[model samples]
Target: MQKTNNLGSIKRLQREYAAFLKSPPPDMTIYLIESSVYECHFSFKGPSETDFAEGIYHGKFIFPYDYPKNPPEVYFFTPNGRFAINTKICLSITSFHPETWTPVWSISSMLEAIRAFMLTPAAGAVGGLESHSDVKKEFAKKSQYYTCPVCGANHQELKKIFLLENDKKNLTENIEHQLKINTSSTEVTSKLSNYDKTEYKLENVEKDHKIIIEKENNNNQQQDIIKEENDIITQNEINNECKEELLTKIENDEINKETKEKEEEINQEDDVLTILKKRQEAEKEKIKHFLENKEEIKEETERNEKYTVINETINIIFYLSIFLIILMVLNLLKIKIIMYFLN
Candidate 1:
């Protein structure tokens, strides 16, 4: 369950890991954590002709849940001679504003950006040191330190794993020839470019020996890169497996939540139907009682009407008999009074 909750974060980390693994930068190296893609460590060699030449530095990268959409956080484990200690550099891709980050840029590009931007003198920026050019050149000459706080090894020892020496003479000759050709085209002024070239070649006797040494060093470095790449791949596989497991768990949790919601909806529907059925039965019983009472009331009203008609007829007959008796008595009294008057 805990793993499932971290699915999105895991997936995001995996994507970044895959990208870094598939297309690694020549100047920078990375290794994944044992069980997590989101957290990995990286080591970067300073670019040539810079103050950090021959200097090695290490840093950590941490991705958030909404990565790509949001940039990750990057911090140096070792202090850069110019930058502040453990300061977060504001990168276009990994900054608070993601809209400014370009899709074309990759981890290599980010590293390049760091190299380019670290020399700026921005006040609010972290890790910017102001040193003289001569001082910087001196530091660059002897920058190899044996102890790495982050990787726990000397830069040369660590780099020994990926060293590859191509042909040094061929490489230097190619560079010198290109410089001569470029110089000739820029200006036709005095044959100064040709003169300088001849003078350099004559004065430099130990050139061949230096070339051999450089060639050997390059070969060693290339070999180290290959070995480190292999190690990174191995670690990335472990990270991917762990991430897959986490995503699967999350999917299951989502399914369970949906199922619970559906069951609750069904239960509510059942309750509503039950209430409606009860209401219908109660309505039916009330109608039945109303019909029975209406019929009984109608019967009582008919019986009362019949009794009232009979009482009215008996009263009328008794009154008519009393009036006939009074008439007969009055006629007899009148006849007696007239006879007494005549006598």
Candidate 2:
């Protein structure tokens, strides 16, 4: 399992290397160790914009088992007169401080930070050895002709190759940009036609939505009269879920803000998708309950209609029997009166 995890880092390194080749750093050349990828060598040009300008610096990068998570140990191989040769350069991005290391910080990032740090006065610290400015300038002059035995290339040659690759990369980007512009021009007319069709569909959908909303809102209002108590309860649940989501997002935002501030030391990565997934799952359950409550309400409404119909039919029959009785009594009274008159 450990080996597999290490392999993940190695594979990632391989991909980073390929990407570096396509877009190589301006004044840095990195080469792999004999057969071990974990150890690599780099020749960096002293940033021309600084006092160390034009000084070629050779360095070694040694990776631990947990690379990326742990920044590599960087050591200067050449006596650039900045720090003692073969001395490790201590910076925030180095193995000197694992707490600040982040997997997202690649080898190029490390080199860039180191290059910037080299411009600072060394002060003869544990990892930094300060030197005279004139001596450093002389070293810069000498750095131009320095060659690495392992890489078998001089500084200028490496710099030439890097610039060529950079130009090619830039040219490729320009070509891609032009292709996009050309493709967009052709797509413009089609997109305009598509926009018209979509506009028609959008109007239709909006009308449909209004109709559906009106119908549902009307039905729900009527149901409120019938099952006002139950609907109020279910509606509260839905409102609570919405309120909870709103509050949760606000709280998460606060937490994220705090986390960002605090975790700067750790450089932790957050899984935003995971957070969203959890919230979505919770809301789905609430929706399921809401729908279930609606179904129950509908079933109850059907039962109520059936009961009302049966009661109305019984009331109608009772009234008809009472009218027949009253008519019979009146007819009997009329017959008795006629008999009395005859007697």
Candidate 3:
């Protein structure tokens, strides 16, 4: 079973590679690496009108044995500012996000996705860089002459060869398509000529003459009917003009009345808005006054607390002084009593 799957993968890869060579994607070319079907080298020119423009970048793709059942590893060997050199970049189409891979996706689609991703921000994705635009532009200038070490081919030279081959293929296709169209038209013309060679008899000629006479009479009757219709249309047009004038006058009157009503409503709305503004201002002033009064009350309470604390501290100090003098007086009395007893 595994061998069968491997064969299937190789076959699929061979088909895709052949198709890519037959009609390569715009601005890109792929080459098999070391003659291995599972590994390929690709190079593409930068998208026009971008920082990466004027640059050609080279990259490598390594396909797993499971092939389309799994995604390919994508790495850029070129020193493009958007991705690290020789590092596998994280992208939905890359091996980093295999869940998004599908068998329907081809090498062309992968190249398109990579090209589009180059123009986006790095956003901290693995192997992505946020290089300055100036730096990227410098790299773009140098990239034109860059040769891939692995591929051993100049980027611009490869691009030229691819463009030449693609142009030849497209021109051939156009020529073949035109030839097909011409052949079909020639066949149709030959068929029509053969159809026109049918024999006609005298009875057919007589029937054709009768048809012409009947057609001429019908045309004369239609002309007369058309003249009558024109007369009726002119009369209806005159009626419509009068009706239109009356409608215009009525519409003008209604429009003037509507304008007057709209103006009155606008004036009423302006007056209401002014009143609301005045009320808002009054409310704001009230709030401001209340806040000021609250602040003043807070300050007064703070001041009172401070004064009470200072008064308490002073009273305690005065009591301590009086108690110390009483102690001194008692000591002096005791000394005098001793002297008297000794005498």
Candidate 4:
């Protein structure tokens, strides 16, 4: 029966995953642990306007055999200090509140909720850890550089790309705005100009031998207008170039400073394979310890049962011996009374 449940769970997971792949949530990355379909690693961008802002937290989703019927357990692998590292965290979507769980809720929805939940006050749960708000903020700042060996990437890389794209976007917007302003100025200047924009028909002077002179005059006026337009366009180009140069320099300096910090953080990241090995060994050890404890408790229970039986036996024997002695004394007293009466 349990095996059947597991098969159903795997099928459900695959279907849900396909749906997620169609239109994945922004900034939330979840991937399967191929060895264990029930296990999935996830990373998400922290909610803004919170202590966890600008942070990327890595964790896992552990599902049960009866899942979709039951919510998955959520664990945080990264040390945000807001959540205990490698501990099962409590959330509405986790097994902590199974009574409220519903099959209608999907993994994507649950993860979205968990990200938002990070900003709220922590419940005093046994598995979770607590830290000062300032400490959490510090962790948040450092989270960007954290690398996941399994994913082979870090938040810093994403940030770097975003920075470059953002710079280009700003440059484009600025140029567009400046172009609009220039166009408006050109319109206003042309409107208020003393020169008339009236078009002269060359056909009207075709019959006259003075047609050649009129055409030359018209050509000279067109050249002057073209020259003025070229000057405005050249000036706009120069301004854009100067603005881009200054922006690039400032952005480059900031990236350089952060580059050193990211280097140091690179050393802190654990190789996923090594982490898996250690985690497996740790889990085995814990299971062994738990089994040993179970055996000890069973032995203790058996000993207590024997002790209770022995005590009961000893009490019964002692009472029977006392009852016999009382009966013997009473018979002796009866015999004495009978002898005294006969006398």
- lDDT: which candidate is best? 3
After the best TM-score superposition of candidate 2, give how far the Cα of residue 238 lies from its true spot, in angstroms. Answer: 64
lDDT of each: 0.63, 0.70, 0.77, 0.70
lDDT of candidate 1 vs native? 0.63
Tens digit of per-residue lDDT, candidate 2, span 123-201: 6555787777788888887776778787465777655554554554555575567567556645754666777767755
**Model 3 stretches astray by more than 4 angstroms:** 1-5, 162-343
Summed over model 4, clashes come to 0
- TM-scores for all predictions: 0.45, 0.45, 0.47, 0.46
RMSD of each: 14.9, 40.9, 27.5, 23.5
Clash count per candidate = 23, 0, 0, 0
lDDT of 1 by residue, 43-132 (tens): 767666677766666776676554554567777655555655477666555665477865455556667777676666645554456667
The candidate with the higher TM-score, 2 or 4, is 4
Distance from true location, Cα of 271 in model 4, Å: 46
Q: Write the per-residue lDDT of candidate 3 for residues 85-135, one digit (tens) a residue.
A: 888899988889988888899998999989999998899999999998999
For candidate 1, which ten residues in a row score worst on lDDT?
161-170
The residue ranges of model 2 lying beyond 4 angstroms of the native Cα positions read 1-5, 159-343
Off by over 4 Å in 4: 1-5, 150-153, 160-343
**lDDT-best of 3 and 4:** 3
Give the TM-score comparing model 1 with the true structure, all chains together: 0.45
